[model samples]
Target: MPTSSTGSNPGYVPRAAVRRRRPAQPTRARTDLARLATRLTERDVWLTEMLHEHKVLTSHHITALAFTGHRTANRRLRELYFMGVVDSFRPLRTAGSAPEHYTLGKAGAELLAARAGVDLPATGWRKDACARIAFSPTLEHTLGINALLVRLAANDHLPLWLSERSATRLWGDWIHPDAYAHHGAAESDQLLPFFLEYDTGSYNLARLEAKLPGYAALAATTGTRTPLLIHTATARREAALRRRLAEPADRLDLPLATGNAQLADPAADSWLPLDSTGPATGRLTLSQLSTHWTNVTPALTPDTTMPTTGRPTTLPWRPIPPRPPADRT
Candidate 1:
């Protein structure tokens, strides 16, 4: 065949002269992940576990749970994020800087699976999935739950944190709490299990009211009424929810309370008994909830409602090793 005069078959564009878009190389994250495996520490492992359980967390929450200070948490988290051990996205905010919210990344999931001797799923977590949660309608509600956990974890009293995912796994589909938790001083002084309902003031009141009966039914079935605690965004929302709870038709014998989420410490003396008309001054700590509501028995150990197969009572990792003391010299 005769070539066109530029390289030239007439009007033919040579393949060498064709502008082609090269396929993007695999992300740096894939190759960088191997370094994370060798550099992983116990603290890093625990952070991954927390992200897996909670689904997402702000750096502040991660610091409160794992590190001694903000700077260290930020530094370590930045490293982990880049190494593909965690992924993060910051949601749009009209005022003030929004903190980056993080979730388990592929490497983190693989590390966890290896630590637990389980196979990692073929398709693990994706950044887009986590990013959607940061921008989702439930973002504020999820943060409210995180706020509660942060405060509880900071206190000297030992608290056990359980995510809604684990709660659903254990308790099945009947009632899905925003979170489930237990606060205690000692084995005997421990408070009963409780389910948290974080209200963002975005849902219909009737829908909120409808769930009360289900809670009551859950109480009856378990032979123990686990207090259903509602944390509302504002005092108005709290008041409105309280009024809804007070309705004669809506009232159930279940132990319930509502708290303003803006309070300094949600787990403290902010929860007011929904059934009380005396005053809000008698708010109780989470553990003290039992002291005020005597009719309801404490939740059974490993709640009877827990489904046999799905209950994951412990993290794949052991208790976080205590941080070594800094050298005084």
Candidate 2:
């Protein structure tokens, strides 16, 4: 055989021959509107709408909301990322790496705008939306709210999980809750519509107490005694918050309950009603909690109110997106 490229030594390989193949170029997200539209699925649309409504969602949250497994979620999300349908960033953590938190990308906004018969700006999506959420001081707060909703959704098939933005649009004048949700018992058909206040223990106890007036106003305005569920980061915080909130909560006749955030089922017996007068008893499950506050009515239809010069409007938007259709074979 002819001498190898290594000159004299047939057994020796040239550096060029052994050089590592050029690392594959990172995939760039597609910007072609036509191509992306064709590739979109029902679930993809739902996810885009969710990102639009929720502002930010971690990979785990998205998976819990729609996907059956992490591997599948990651692969599909990677595809969406490359298609510019969703943009993501991984926050720096002191310990292990953080999961990528995703937001609506430019392409996603365009799609949503087109579907709604509105312009891109009407969708309230900006190129910097992802960056803004990624670096915001309230990122953890947002995540906490999302985490609670995700648990309710993934585990119990919660009927409604409204985002803070949507909740603000509807009730911001009275009270800007962290979120609004409806949870039902596994065995019963009764669903409890409640406003969620996810406390991270960042604010003074007085600040927590101050929120009662708005909630009272909301109840008075709508004539709906919606329960306000306060979830604290720790049991200790929950205890302190309950004590701080009890007097105001009672005086306003605001239906309030406190729970410590738990990794286990959030629907479990974790909540304690503030109206309790006696010493410690066991907590109540969300279903049991619903039974405790019989004054709380079922959620009203979205169209129950109309806007006039003097009248308030009901929540115009649906609390939850329509469930995605089953995947086609």
Decoy 1 TM-score against native: 0.77
Error of 2 at 299 (Å): 5.6
Report the C-alpha lDDT of model 2 over 30-91, residue by residue, as the tens digit: 35667778998889988888888788877777777677787798899888887778888766
List where candidate 2 sits over 4 angstroms from the true fold: 1-32, 185-189, 277-281, 298-300, 304-316, 327-329
lDDT of 1 by residue, 179-260 (tens): 7776665365446557888777778778778777877776777677777888877888888878777873235666788887
| lDDT of predicted model 1 | 0.63
Q: Rate the local accuracy (lDDT) of all candidates.
A: 0.63, 0.71
Clashing residue pairs, backbone N/CA/C < 3 A, model 1: 3-8, 3-9, 4-8, 4-9, 5-8
Give Cα distance to truth, residue 108, candidate 1, Å. Answer: 0.3
The lDDT of model 2 is 0.71
Model 1 misplacement above 4 A: 1-37, 122-124, 247-251, 276-281, 295-329
- For candidate 2, give the lDDT of residue 165: 75
